[model samples]
Target: MHYALNVYGADINPLAVLISRVRTARKVEFAIGAIGASVVKRARADRRFGIETTLANRDKWFRLEVLTELSKLRRAIRSCEELWARRFLWVTLAETVRLTSNDRTSTYKLHARPKHEIDGRNVSPIDVFSDLVSRNADSFAFFRKKLRDANAVSHARYRASTDIALVDNRESKKCWADVAPFDLMMTSPPYGDNQTTVTYGQHSYLPLNWIDLADIDPKVDTELLRTTQEIDRRSLGGRDPVSNEEEERLFAASTTLKNFAEALPDTPSDGHIRLVRFYRDFQASLEAMIGQMRQNSYMIWTVGNRNIAGKQVPTDTVLSELMEHAKCSTVTMLTRRIHHKRMPDRNASSATMREEKILLLRKR
Candidate 1:
């Protein structure tokens, strides 16, 4: 909407896709304040006391009181007549769950707080949800005002096409073919597999359990929430045992990758298999994204080098080489210092990088 251009995006994470859709939806109601108040009022009046989620070890992650309060909020949000408003409320509720749950907020993994910490905490889910709703509603109002100032709003709707879907780019099928031949592509692919780099799925697991799956996408399977690590496991390269043919194709396409692999010590402890599998999946995803771009289109990729076995993987160089191999030429590369990007500072498998590389390329 900022540029009044049609936009399309895809992600394998259902929660991510839902948030994207809610934020980019063409028709959005401006009465979030009234809607939020109504939700809170309804939740306060609600007498239902049943727990809503069957997440494994639910009691361990949430106190009994917290679970009951959250269930009331969920039921109230579901009662809203408008789907868009309900989706917006759900996002707010997800944040509230993150704040009120026993899980520590500092880490992506779902580690529960100590018994004393959990017991001493005086958090009220309803209060957190109410505050969040008010704050988020204000933010949305400001955003809408800016869009209106920019003349991007027409008849209370955004003036451009917006499409967001839950799509796994590694799949062979061109799920985004309907909107193919894009003139510009910009993305920040994961630096490495989510398990080692960032446990995004685990971070989302708790909130997802309380959220209505149908609100996210009908195609999203409940099996993804069966375990805290299920979503991460389904992510790129999360599943192990990279095929020899895939390794060969990836290494053949990017000499930098081959050299990096060759440089690793021949030991299971060297993280050789993990590195190869991640890059193989990365290459496949890159190919799928590039295939949808129009000839001569510009592509901007933001990537970061990750460490494996105390060695830095030159992700920028490897990505450039891979793009070149795919008949794309690098236009320029820029380096930016990371200021506030969320990352694990002490991950055992991968050390944090202080900077990121942005590569500009043109499809040939």
Candidate 2:
């Protein structure tokens, strides 16, 4: 699918996505085979990176071809100045790779390396690269449109161009150091761990595997790619919280989460742990955001009630408690019907996010 560049305004940073890849322990591999040490060194030195030779579940030749094609494309684009915009374009190519890969099956997530597979009709890497080049201008065009709008606003309001700052926010708990306080802070935190809800890590795995980390942003640490799920795990609730007493106290702070946890129907221990893990980190991140905002500044949270252990987790109510705990008062809570939203339909925990809630809060 094409990006939401001109439509719903999905406003994603490819660097963040790529940086998430870097944050993981997973490193990109070159096409499988003994290209030996020199190629590996070259792959690292050059931004036109390689793929994991150990990567399984795809046509070997096809993977190599894509890698080769990608190398040439990177060299061809070396003269381009629109780094971020071009990274998005490369992401489009990465998407094409996913859509063309044998992994493009009926699975709910892309990480499932299928078993007992056979070759079928697939687009060659060259063909995909050709198609990508034709539409490359569109990527730059979208960025240029945004640039013009930004410049126009600056000229009218301030009589000069404005500087853009790209901060690395892959870490939720860590404080942004020496930052000026904000008049407003608006964000939509994840409903749950990406695993049970969305396979965001898996979605980026392929793209990250193919694109050069340097091409996207040199700051994008490939160390994040230690594992396919590293970013997801690094996310809220991705890990075990502190002491049990602390977890219990934090968990008990939100009656909504506590009640939801209590209502869990015949769940496994991991399911219960996952729920706790999410809200604890969610709580921590919320607290950090509040600390960054000016007193009396407004904050808005648009959250979804994701199903966990077959129970609906009232994220809005939970967040209201969190905001109150963090010295913010909930001004209002509203619900909006979700006529359109993407989710794993077959996923038992997430098949029921048919609506979302909007929570407005004022920092006291």
Stretches off by above 4 angstroms in model 2 are 1-67, 78-88, 105-108, 111-118, 129-136, 139-143, 146-179
Per-residue lDDT tens digits for candidate 1, residues 1-364, read 6787898888888888888888898999789878998899998898989988888898999998999999999999998988889889999999999999999988788889999999999988998999999999999899888888999988998999998879787773466767788899888887686777878798899999999989888898999998899998888878868888988889898888899888987665737888988888888889888888899999999998888777788999999999998889999999998987777888855564778999999999
Provide the lowest-lDDT 10-residue window in model 2: 1-10
In model 1, pairs of residues that clash are none
lDDT of 2 by residue, 1-364 (tens): 0221111111123434433332221112111112222222343355555543333433542445555654655444343454543454455557556666656545436643344442335355545655554454444345444544655322223222122222323342233344436666557777787787866556666566656667755555565566767656666667765578867877667877787777776656677777888887778767766776789889888898888767677788888997887788999998888885667778877766778898989999
- Predictions: Cα RMSD each: 1.5, 8.6
Give all candidates' CA lDDT scores.
Answer: 0.87, 0.58
How accurate locally is residue 84 in candidate 2, as Cα lDDT from 0 to 100? 42
